[model samples]
Structure formats: C-alpha cells, structure tokens
Target: MRIGMIGCGVISQQYLASFDQLPDVQLVAVADLDPARAAAAAEGREGVRALSVDELIADPAVDTILNLTIPAAHADVDLRAIAAGKNVYSEKPFAVTTKEGAEVLVAALAAGVLVGSAPDTVLGTGTQTARAAIDEGLIGSPIAATATMVTPGHERWHPQPDFYYTPGGGPLLDMGPYYLHALVTLLGPVASVIGAASRTRDVRTIGSGPRAGESIPVSTDTHVTGVLVHESGVLSTLVMSFDAVATSAHPIEIHGTEGTLAVPDPNRFSGDVTVHRLGGEGWEPVPTAGGYEEAGRGIGLHDMAVRGPELRASGELGQHALEVMNAVLESAHSGARIEIASHVARPEAVALEDVRAAT
Candidate 1:
C-alpha cells in the first residue's frame, strides 16, 4: 500500500522510522499546512514528494492517507481522503466530537474505503501478552480493571502546548485514547460512563521551547476520573490527569476470580506483562504470546494493508472510544450516567511474529 502522510510533526517521525521495517507499506508522499515541514520529511527519503495537503490527498499514486493532524482536523482530513477514494488511518481521539467521528465512518462506508485509527499500541507485546494470559485463564474469569495515567503537565516539554489546554485537548480527550482503547481491547465496549473532573489553574506558564515563559489559558479539565461499565459486565476504572506529578501504580491492572494481571503502558509498543496468581507469592512474567514483536507506530497501517477491511485498529473502535470519552466528560458536568450509543466488536488477536513477516 502506497501511503501519503498528511502531517509532519513530532509523531510523524515515529511513523517514518517504522516504514522501512514494515514490508507491506511504503511512503510515497507527505504533506502539511507548512510546506517547509513537508519538505523536511521528504528530504532524505527516496521516491517521496512534498506536496500541498490537497494535492497529496488527490494524488493518484497514493492509496491511503496517514492522518497525523491535530484532533480538530482528524474528521475533516479523513472525509476528504475518503472522497478522494483512499483509505484513511488517523491519530487518536478520532475527532473533536462524536457527531463528526460518525460522519467520517458513514462517508467511508459509502465510499468503500477503510478507516483506521491509532493507539494500535495495544497490538504490541505489552497489552497482547496480558490479553493472552487472560484468555489462557491465568486471571480466571475477568472481573474488573483499573487504568491510570498522570503527568504534571505537557507545557514542561512540548514546544507548542496551547492545544493541550484547549477544549478538545484535555487530559481526558488528549491522553484518554491510549488507556480507553486498551481497556476496550482487554475488557469490551463500554456500556455506560460516570465521571468527575477538576482543573487546578486557569493559566499555565510554558517551561520549554521558543514559547518558554509564555502563559496559555486552560479551558478544559486537567484531572479526570471515571468508571467505564463494559458491556461484558466488567467494570474498568480510569484516572487520567495532567494535574499530578507521578504515581507508582501500574498503567493498567486487571483482576479476576483467580488472580491479577499488570499490563504495561498501552501508549507504548512493548513492556513487561506480569501476573500474580491467587495461590502465587509474587508477580510472574507472562511470556510474550501475541502481537507484532518489536513493532512501532506504522504497524497499524501495515496491519490495515494486509487485513484490508478487517483491520484491528479500526475507525469503528476509535469512534466507540471517542464516544465513551465524550460521554464521560458530559457525565462529569451533568452528574449523571451516560450510555454509549456506539459499539465495536473486539478485534482479532494478532499471533506473535516478526514485524516484517506481516507482509
């Protein structure tokens, strides 16, 4: 599959690094609102052209669009790519709103194009190994889960951190995708959500980059906590915060009738998956049993190329996750439980294999 990458920002570098490792996909073109950024990405690569966003989307040689644009532009870019008769794989959060996310899916279906989304990190060894252990009954009948992500703030490091404080870029919307997607992958679709949120300050001072010493206003919640009641009757508790410094808690922990499983960070591609049995003394490492070994960002696009419509990191799942998150925020302010209108079947498990073998 020939890919046309539409954003040349921080995350694009990760995808570019993995393109050579993925045998099923190749980068042919790149685009950005800034022509200089696009040119920089295409510089050292062969057979890659820097083009305007419209020209790249309409290019006949490009079969798929790898959308790395910001949250607000995700749906718009995807719709345009679908109109151009190309598949689309976008970054996390799907879109700023569920209504927009649904529009992208409806249009893609009508156009006979595939729509995929990120946080495919779940397809990596960390989450997949934990999944295999659960399926193997190491955790017995799954009962509940807890997912936690916390950081003091992103302004300390990110060059341009204004978006992190905006409405579509809160802790829940910004960092929730990785944890929520992983939870759904381990548990199932969320049936209902109840949430409570808080923000510490109205203005944040940038600590790094050219924007250092600049103050950005915070218009969104910085600390978010919620309960996701899965359709399978499993209860997954979530805590995502930009207000806290750090925590010793595992990124995710699943408890069952017989034991508990500690899952690695879903934002990453690989880590140690450990299990503590009911009769066991200490946490034992679960052997790597599934997913793409040594994979990275573009592995999801590679999976899309090989599996076509059955791609696991699907927009359906992304949309469901987005809806769940938006509902959580709504519930936070409304003081009521919100029911999810969208659902997605659990993706097929990927058998463990070399990254290049996906071809």
Candidate 2:
C-alpha cells in the first residue's frame, strides 16, 4: 500500500517509522501546511515526496492517506481523501464532533474506501493482554470500570500547544480516546453517557519548554467526569483533568464477577496487567504471551504483524472512540444522558497459539 501522510508533526514520526517497517507499505508522499516542516519530515526517506494536501490526496500513486492534521482539520482532510477514493487512517479524536465523524464515515462508505482512526492502543500489549484474559473468562463478566487522567497541560513541550485548550484539543477529545477505546474494546458499545465538565482555571502557566512560565488562557473545559453505561451492563466512570494532580493508579480498571482486571495506562501500547480474583486478597499479575516491549510502536506494529490486517488497532478504533467521547461531551452540554448512535462490536479474540502458528 502506498501511504501519503497529511501532517508532519510529532506523532507522524511514529507512523512513519511503523509504515517504513511494514513490508507491504510504502511512504509515497507527505503533506503539511508548512512546506518546511513537510520537507524536513521527508528528508532521508526513500520515495517520499512532499506535496500540498490537494496534490497528495489527488495523486493516483497513493492508496492510503494518513490524516495526522490537528484535531480541527480532521473532517475536512478525511472528506477530501474519501472523495479521492483513498482509504484513510487518521489520528485520534476523528473529528471535533460526532456529527462530523458521521459525515466522514458516510463519505468513506459511499466512496467504497476503508476509513480508520488512531487510539489503536487497544492493539497494544496492555489492552490486548487484558482482552485475552477476559476472553478466557479470567475476569468473568465485567460489571464496572474506571479511568482517570490528570495532566498539567501540554504547553510544556508542544511547540504549538495553544490549540490544546480549544474545542478540538480538550482533555475529553485529546486523551479520552485512549481510555474509551480500551473500555469499548474490553466491554462493548456504550449505551448511554451522563457527564459534567468545567474549566477550573481561566489561565495556566507553562511549566517547561521555551514557553515556560508563560500564561495561556483556557477556552475549553479542563475537568470532565462521565458515567458510561455499556450495553453489557458494565458501568464505567471516566474522569479527565488538567487542573488537578493524581496519584499512581491503573489508568483503567474493569471489575468482573469472577475477578478484577487492572490495566496499565492506556496512553501507551504495552505494559503490565494484573487480575485479582474474587477471593484473592491481592492482585496477581497476568503473564503476557505476546506483549511488546516498546510503547507506541507496539499497537500499530502488533496489529500488522499479528493480524496481517490493519483493523487490529487501526484508525477505525480511533474514530469509534471519537464518537463515544463526543457523545459524552454532548450529554454534558444537554444535561442529559446521551446515547451513542454508532455501534462498534467488541473484536473476536485470537488465540495465542494461532498467532504463533501464523508467525
């Protein structure tokens, strides 16, 4: 597959490396609003040519277009790629709103092209091992889940982090996808959501980087809490914050009738997983058979290496997560529990022996 990258930012480096490692994929071209940035990313890359967004999408040589643009531009770029009859693999928070994500999905379906989004972290070792254990009935029937993320703000290292406080880059849209994807992967589609959100501080001071000590006015909600009712009757409490501090806790925990499974942070691809049985006094770590040692590369590469298909942790999961998170925000805004319109079934489990046989 000839892949064209739309944005050449920090995350794009991971995509570039993963695509380069794949024997079936070729990084044919790249596009960025900043010509210099695009040129820099294309440097030393074989067969990579920097082009304008339009040119890259319209190019017949490219089979897939990776949409790595900022959150606000996701829908527009995806629509264009679909119109050009190209498959799309986009970054997380597929769009600023579920409505926009729906439009993109419709376009891709009409165009007869596959559309997927990031937060493919589920394909990572941490979430994948958890899924395997759940499939084996190690945790039995999940009854509840909780995910918490508290960050000081991205102004620290991001060269252009101002957009993070904007609508498309808030905590719910930005970091919510990872945890939400893991939840949906472990459980199933969320049936309803009730949420509350607020901006604790009007401005924040940058903690590090060249912008250190600089004040940034916040425009979007920085603190959000939501209760998600899954179709499987699992109630999940999700919390995100930019104004507070949090102690060490598994980013996600799923409680089941037979046992409780504690998953590592969902932000990265691979980590340790533990399960505490109903009668057990302490948590016991579940040994992972096919876990990756690296972080971001694990999920994407594992999907490609193990499944021989892109859907493993591919862009599709990211799009689904985007819809779920947007539903939470919408529910918060209307002061009512909102039901997500999209339905994403939990993936079927693949046996480790089968995976080994294929390998």
Candidate 3:
C-alpha cells in the first residue's frame, strides 16, 4: 500500500517510524496544512514527496490515505480520499459526530474503497492476549469490565493544546476510542449506554510550548462516566477524565465467573496481560497469546493492506465504536439510556507473530 499521509503532526512520527519496519506499506507522499512541516517530514526519506493536501489526495500513485488530521477534519479527509478512489485509514474517534462518521463509511462502501480507523492498539498483544484468555475460558462467562483513563489535562504537554478542549476534543471523545474499541473487542458490540459527565472549568491554561499560560475555552465534558451494556449482557463501567490528577487503577479489568483479566492500556502496542483465577493466589502473567508482536500505529493499515476485507481494524468497527461513544454523551445530556443503532462483530484475532516478518 502506497500511503499519502495527510497530516504531519506529532502522531505522524510513530507511523513514519513504523513504515520503515513494515514491508507492506510505503510512504510515497506527505502533506499538512503547514507546508514546512510536510517538507520536514519528507526530508532524508528516499522517494517521499511533500505535496499539498489536495495534491496528495489527487495523486493517483497514492493507494491509501493515512488521515492524521484533527478530529474535526477526519470525515472530510476520508470522504475526499474515497471519492478519489483511494482507501482511507483515519486517526480515532472516527469523526466528531456519529452522523459524519456514518457518512464516511457509507461513502467508502459505495465507492468500493476500504476504510480503517485508529486505536488499532487493540490489535497489539496487550488487549489481544486478554481476549485470548476469555476465549480460552480462563475467564469463564464474561460478566463485566472497568475502564479508566484520567489525566490532569492534555494542555500540560500537547504543544497545540487548543483542540483538546473543543467540541470533538474532550476526554471521552479524544481518548475513549482506545478503551471503547478494546471493550468491544473483548466483550462485544454495545447495545445501550447511560452516561453522566461534568467539566470543572470553562477554560484550560496551556502549560507548555510557546502557548504556555495561554487559556483555551472548553466546550465539552472533561470527566465522563458511563455504563456500557454490551450485546452479550456484559456491563462495562467507563471513567474518562481530563480533570483528574492521577490513578493507580489498572487501565482495564474484566471480571468473569471463573477469573479476572487485567488488560493493559490500549493506547500502546504492548504490555503484560495478567490474569487472576477465581481460586488462585494472585495475578499471574498470561503469556503473549495473540496479535501482532512489536506492532505500532500503522499496523492496522498493514492489516488492511494484507487482509483486504478481513482487516480487523475496519471502518465498520470504527463507526460502531464512534456511535457507541456519541450515544454515551447523548445519554448524559438526555438523562436516558441511549440505544446503539450500529453493531459490529469482534474482529478476528491475530496469533502471536512478528509483524516485520509478515510483511
């Protein structure tokens, strides 16, 4: 797959690094609203051209678009790419709204182009191993789960922290995809959700970079909690916050009749998956049992490149997760349980294997 990466931001660095290790993908072109950033990204890379965003999308040599743009631009970029007869792999949340996300998927489907989304972190060994444990009945009859992600705020470190506080940039929307995607992967599609949310302040002061001390207005929920009723009847509790100081809780914990599974943070590619049997003494480390070993951000794109329709981090799953999240927020505002209209099968598992060799 020849990739034309549409946003040259901090996250793009990880994908660029992974492209070198992935034989199935090629970084053919790069683009960003900031032309200089695009040029810098292409510097010293063999045969990589830095083109305008429009030029890159129109470039017939590019088979797929790696849309790393801001959340607000996700669906637009994806739709444009699909219209140009190119496949798309977008960064998370799918889109700012469920309507927009659905539009992107519908367009891609009609165009006969593949669509994939990020938070592919689930395709990594950490979450995959936990799934394997449940599948193997180490944790029999899955019952419930708890997912927690808390931080003081992204303003503490993100250079351009304005977007983190906007409509599409709150704690749940910005960071929930990783956890939600993992939950669906471990449990199943969510059937309904009830959520409550709060924001501590109206503005956040930037704590780093040239914008230090600059305050950005907040228009979205900062601390979001919800109960996700999975289709399988498992209830997952979620707590996503940008107003918290710290936490010692495991990123995710799945409880079942036989045992419990401790899942690693879904933001990364790897971690130790520990399991505690019902009658066992303590948590024991589960051997890596599934997913691409030593994977990275672009592994989903590689999965799409290799698996075609069988790709795990597919747009259907992405849109389903996106709708589930939006429903959570809507439920918060309406004070009612929101029913999810979308459903997706849990993606196929990746047996423990070196991604580098697969390519």
Candidate 4:
C-alpha cells in the first residue's frame, strides 16, 4: 500500500524507518505546515515526494494518510482525509474531546473508509502474551486494575513542547490513552468513569535539558485521578500526572482472583511481561511467541503498514480506546460519572504457531 504522512515531526521519523523496511508498504508523499520541514523529512527517502497537505491527500498514488499532527489538529486532518476518500491512520487521543472523536468516527463510517489510531501497544508480543495467559485462565477472573503515569511536565526536551501545557494536551489526554487502551484490551468496555482533575501548579520549570530552568505557564490539569467501571465488574483506578515525581510502580497492574499480572509500561510495545500468583513468592516471566522481532517505536503504525487491514489493534479497538479516554476526561470535567456508548468486540485468538511462522 502507498501512504502519505502529515506532520513530519520526531515520531514521524520512526514511522518512516519502519515503512522503509516493510516490503509491501511504500511512502508515496509527505506534507507539513512548513514546506522546509516536510522537504527535509522527505530528503534522501526513496520513491517519496514532498507536497502540500491538500496535494498529498489528493494524490492518486496514495492509498492512506498518516495523521501525525498535534492533538488539536487530529480531528480536522482525519475529517479531511475521510472527505478525500482515503484510509487514515492517526496518532493517539484521536481527538481532544469525546464529541470531536465521535465526529471523526461518524465521518469515517459515512465515507466507508478505515480509521485507526496509535497506542497499538496491545498488538505487541508483550500484550498478546498477556492476553493468551488471561484467556488460558492463568490469572483467573480479573477483579481490579491500576495504572499510573507520572512525569515532570514536557517543557524539558521537546523542541516544541509548549502545546503540552495547553488545553487539548494534559496528562489525561496526552498519556492516558496508552493505559486506557491496555485496560480496555485486558478488561472490557468501560461502563462508567468517575474522576477529579486539578492544576497543581500555575507555572512549571523545565527540570533538565538545554532549556533547563525555563518557566512555562500551565493551563490544563496536571493531575488526574479516576475510577473506571468495566462491564465485567472490574474496577480500574487511573492516575496520571505531570507534577509528581517518579515511582517504582509498573505502568499497569491487574489483580485477578488467581494472581496478579505486572504488565510492562504501555508506552512501549515490547518488554518482559511477568505474572505473580496470589501466593507465589516472586514474579514469573511469561515468554513471548514470535511476531514482530524488533518492536518498532510506533508499533501501531508499523503494524498497520506491514500487516494491512487485518492487524488487530488498528480498527475498532483504537476507536474504542478513543471513546473510553474521552469519556474519562468528560467525567472529570462534568463532575458526573460518564458512561461509554461505544463497544468493541474482543478479537479472536491467533495460533501461537501462526505468529511464529509469520516471523
């Protein structure tokens, strides 16, 4: 498949490299607000052209458009791609709000085009192995889960990280999707969300970097705490913050009647996944069967480029994640528990031998 990429930022480079390695995929064109940035990104790349966003979307050679713009621009880019009658693969948080996310979904459905988003970490072997273990009843019935993400705000290293402190870019919307998607994958659809959010600091100092000690005014919530009620009666407490110090807590920890599974950080697609039985003395590592040998940084985008439309995490699963994440933010804002309206069916099991063979 031939694809065009919008927003040639740092993450886009990873996508470009992975696409280069996939024999079936081709990077047809690239577009960015800055022509120089887009040209520089496309330079020395084989068989790719630099064009305006409209021109790239209109290109007959491109079958799909990868939306890599900032959080606020996601919906607009997706809507334009849908109007152009092209499949779209977007970055995480689908949109800033539930209403915007729903609109993107509606447009995709109406246009008969496929739409996928990032945080496809579930497609990685780490998550798939965990899923297999759960399906085998190794963990018994899941009862509760907890996810935490704490970091010193983003003004430290990102060349253009100012947007992260603004309205459409906070802990809940910025880093929540990874954990939320993992929750939905391991558990089921979230039935309701009760949350509280706050802006802990009016201004944050860049901790470490060349821009160290720089001050950035914060406009969005820096800390968020929520309880997510899944359809299976599993309660998940989610905590995300940009104002707190780091901790030893795993990104995700699920407690089942039989045992507790310690999942790797959701920010990464591959890592060591361990499980500890209720009475076990120590954690036992679960070995991965084979799939993508080297987990690409953007595993979701890589999988979509290489595996085509059949990839598990690229379709309804992504949409479901977006819906749940948006619901969480809405719950925090409205001071009411928000119920998710969208549903994603569980994916069918794939044979381990099949995955091994694919590699």
Candidate 5:
C-alpha cells in the first residue's frame, strides 16, 4: 500500500513514525495546508516527497490515501480519494455528521474502493487480549461494561485546540471513538442509546503555544454520558468529559456472570489486561493472547493492506460507531432513547503475532 498522507498535523507524526515498522505500507507522499509543514515531514525520508493536497490526491504513485485531516474534512477527503479509485483510511469520528458518513460509505461501495478508520488501537494486544478472554468465556456470559475518560481540556496541552470545541469536535466525538471502538470489539454493535450532556462554558482559554491565553469559542458538548445497549443485550455505560479534572477509574471495565475484565485505555496500542474469575482471590493479569505485538498507529493500514475488504478497522465499523455517537447526542437533545439503524459485525479477533514479520 502506497500512502499519500493528507494532513501533517500532530496526529500525522504518530502515523509517520508507524510507517518505519509497517513493512506493508509505504508513505510515498505527504501534503498539508501549510506547504512548509508538509515539506518538513518529507525531509530526509527516502523516496518520500511533499505535494499539494490536490497533487497528492491525484498522484498515481499513491494507491491509498491516509486521510489525517481534521474531523470536518474527513468525508470530503475520503470522497475525493474514492472518486479517484483509491482506497482511504480516515481519522476518527469518520465524519462530522451521520449523513456525511453514510454518503462516504455508499460512494466507497459504488466505486469498489476500500475505506477504513482510526481507533485501530483495539487491534493491539491490550484490547485484543481482553477480547480473547471474553471469547474463551473467562468472563462468562458478558453482561455490561463502563468506559470513562475525563480531562480538564485539550486546550491545556494541544497547541491548536480550537477544533476540540467546534461542531465536529467535543469530548464525545473527539475521544469517544477510542472507547466506542473498543466496546464494540469487546461487546458488539450498539442497538440503541440514551444520553445526557453538559457544557461548562462557551469558550476556553488556550493554556500553551503561541496562542496561549487566547480564548476559543465552544460550540459543542464538553461532557457527554450515555448508555449504549449492545445488540448482544449487554449494556455499556460511557462517560466522556473534557470539563473535569481527573479520576481514579479504570479506562474501561467489562462485567459478566462469572467474572469481570479490566481493559486498558483504547487510545494506545497495548497495555495490561486483568480479570477476576467467579471465585478468584482478586483481579489477576491475563497473559497476552492475541493481536500484533509492539504495534502502532498504521497497523490498520497493514490489516487493510492484507485483508482488503475484510479489514478489521473497517469504514463500516467506523460509520456504525459514528452513528451510535451522533444518536447519543440526539438522544441527549430529544430526551429519548435513539435506536441505531446501522449494525456492523464485530471485528475478527487478532491472533498474537508480530506485525513487522507478517509483512
């Protein structure tokens, strides 16, 4: 897979670093709204060059587009790449709206091109190991889960945090994908959702960078809590907040009739998975049993590269997660439980392996 990365922002750095380990992927070109940024990213990288967004999208050498653009541009970039008969892998939230996300999927299907999305973090050992235990019935008869993420705000660390407060941004849309994707992997697709949300202020003061002390407008919910009723009859409680200070809660926890599983954060590639059996003394660590060892961001591209349309981090899953999220927000506003119209098969469990060797 020859990749033309369409954004050179902070998130792009992780993907760039991931490329060296992903033998199945070749980042042939990079583009950013800021030409200097794009050029800098390509510098000293053998055979890689910087091009305008247009040039990169049209470049025949690039068969796949790594759409690292902001949430607002996700659908547009994907549509363009699909129109050009190229596969696309986008960042989280898929698109700003459910309609745009659906359109991107329909276009990809019509064009016979592939689409994948972020939060592939679940394909790593951390989440995958827990998934393995669940499948093996270590935690028999899965019943419920709780996922929680809280922060003062991204404005404290991110140099450019404006997008974190916009329409397509916010705690649920920005950070929810990681938790949502993991829940789907551990449980299954959501059947319906009920939600409530709150925003503390209308603006945020940037804490660092050249724009430090600058205030940005807030146009979305900062704290979002919801209950996702999975198709498997499991209930997962989700709390995503940017307004809070901190917490001691595990990132996620899965409960079952026999036992419970402690899942690590889904934002990264790996972590320890612990479980307590029906009569166990305490929570015991589960040995890593599945997923790519020492994996990173672009592993999804490698998965897509090898699996083609059967890739685990698929656009269909992304869109389903997206709809589940938007419906939560809609439920928040309407004070009603929203039924999800879309459903996606749970992604296949990853067998324990080294990604570098697979390529």
Candidate 6:
C-alpha cells in the first residue's frame, strides 16, 4: 500500500516516524493546505514527493491516502480520495458529526475502496493485553467498565489549540474516540447511552505559541460524563474532561465476575495491564497476548492492507464510535437515553505477535 499522506501538522510527525518500519506500506507522497509545509515534510526523504492535494490524490503510485486533516475536513478529504479510486485511512474524531462520518462510509462503499480510522493505538499491547485477559476468561463474565481522561486544557502546550474549543472539538468529541474505541474493542457495540455535560468557561487563553495569551471561544462542552450500555449488557462509564487539572483514575478499568482489570491508557502502544481477582490480595500483571509488539500509528494501514474487509480499525467502527459520541451529547442536552442506530461487529482480536511480515 503506497501512501500519499495528507496534512502536515503535529500529529503527522508520529505517522512519519512510524512509516519507516511498516513494511507493507510506503510513504510515496505528501500534501497539505500549506505548500511550504508539504515541501518541508518531503525535504530529506529520498523517494517521497510533495504534491498538491489534487495531485497526490490522482498520483498513480499512491494507492492509499493517509488523511491527517483537521476533524472538520476529515469527511471531505475522505470523499475526495474515494472519488479518485484510493483507499483512505483517517485520524480520529472521524468527522465533526455522525452524518458526515456516515457519508464517508457510504461513498467508500460505492467506490469500492477501503476506509480506516485512527486510535490504532488499541491495536498495540496495552488494550490488547486487557482484551486477551477477557477472551481468556480471566475476567470471567464482563459487567462494567470506566474510562477517564482529564486535563486543564490542551491550550497549555499545543501551538494551535483553537480547534479544540470549537463545535467540532471538545472533551467528548476530541478525546472521547480513544476511550470509546477501546470500550467497543473490549466490550462490543453499544446499544444506548445516558449523558450529562458541562463547561467551566466561555473563553480559554492560549498558553503557548505565537498565539500565547490569546483568548479563544469555547463553543462545546469541556466536561462530559456518560454511561454507554453495550449490546452485551456491559455498562461502560465515561468521564472526559478538559476542565480538570488532574485525577488519580486509571485510564480504564473493566470489572467482571471473577476479577477487575486495570487497563493502561488506550492512547498508548504498550503498558502493564494488571488484574485483581475475587480473592487476590493485589493486582497481578497480564502478559502481552496481542497486537503489534513495537508498533506505532501507521500500523493500522498495514492491518488494512493485509486484512481487507476484516480491517480492525475500520471506517464503520469509526462511524459507530462517532455516532456513539454524538448520541451522548444529544442525550446530555435532552436528558434522555439515546439509542444507537448503527451497529458494528466487534473487530476480530489482534493475535499476540510482532507486526513484522514473515520473511
């Protein structure tokens, strides 16, 4: 899968670093709204070229478009790539809204191209280890879980934090996908959600970059709390916050009849996954039993290239996660339990192994 990477930004650096080791995928070209930025990305690379978005999409050597555009442009870029007969793999918060996300899927289906999404971090050992425990029946029958993410705000470090406060951005919409994706990966699809949300301030002062001390409008909820009722009857409680300074909570925890598993951050590639059983005195570590052992961001594209329709980090999963996040916000405003209209099968578990293709 030769790739044309779109968007040259902070997140793109991670994917750039990752592409070097993924044997099944190659970075053939790159593009961004800013031509200068695109050129800079291609500068030291021997075979990679910087092209306009239009040129990259039409480039015969580029069979896949790695979309790293902002949330608002995800669907548009995806639809464009699909139109040009290219497979697309996007960064998360798949799109600003479920309607937009769904449209990306529909177009891909009609175009006969594959669509994939990020937070492929879950395809690493951290969450996958937790999953292996569950599948091994160490956690017994799953019952409930909690996923938490908290921060004062992204303005403290991000050079450009304006997008994080707008409608398409928020604690739930921006940071929710990681936790939601992990939950779905562990528990299966959700059936409904009950939500409540709040915001601490109407304006935020950017703390870094050229825009330091500049105030940006906050149009979305800064803190969101919700209960996702998985179709399997596992209830996952979620608390995502931009208003909080810190917390002692684990990134996630799964409770079942026999034990409770402390899952590492789903946003990372690997961590110690531990479990405490019914009569245990302390938590014990679970060995890594799945995912790309030393993998990084672009590993999902590798997965897509090899797995075809069974791609784990699928566009359908991205859309389902987007719908779940949006439904929670709708429930927050309406004070009603919102039922999810779309359903996706839980992606097949990653086998415990290294990602290197067989020699």
lDDT of 1: 0.93
lDDT of 1 by residue, 1-359 (tens): 99999999999999999998898899999999999999999999999999999999999999999999988899999999999999999999899999999999999999999999998999998988888888888889999999999999999999888888997898888989999888888887899999999999999999999989999999999999999999999999999999999999999999999999999999998999998999999999888999899999989998998899999999999999999999999999999999999989988888888887655
Question: Model 5: per-residue lDDT, tens digit, 76-192?
Answer: 999999999999999998999999999999999999999999989999999999999999999999999999999999999999999999988999999999999999999989999
TM-score of each: 0.99, 0.91, 0.99, 0.92, 0.99, 0.98
| Per-residue alpha-carbon lDDT of candidate 3 for residues 261-342, written as tens digits (9 for 90 to 100) | 9999999879999989989999999999998899989999889988998899999998998898888889999999999999
Query: Candidate 6 lDDT, tens digit per residue, 33-74?
Result: 999999999999989999999999999999999999999899
Specify the poorest-scoring 10-residue window by lDDT in model 3: 350-359
Q: Write the per-residue lDDT of candidate 4 for residues 132-225, one digit (tens) a residue.
A: 7787788899999999999877766675576788877888788988888778777877887888888878887766657777787888888889
Candidate 5 local lDDT, residue 170: 97
Q: Which residue pairs show backbone clashes in model 1?
A: none
Question: Could you tell me the lDDT of residue 294 within candidate 6?
Answer: 89
lDDT of each: 0.93, 0.78, 0.93, 0.78, 0.95, 0.92
The prediction achieving the highest lDDT against the true structure is: 5
lDDT (10s digit) by residue, model 2, range 137-202: 898888899999988767766766787898987888989988888888888778888998888788
lDDT of 2 at 319: 63
Query: Residue 318: error of model 4 in Å?
Result: 3.3
Q: Is candidate 3 or candidate 5 better by lDDT?
A: 5
Error at 286, model 1, angstroms: 0.9
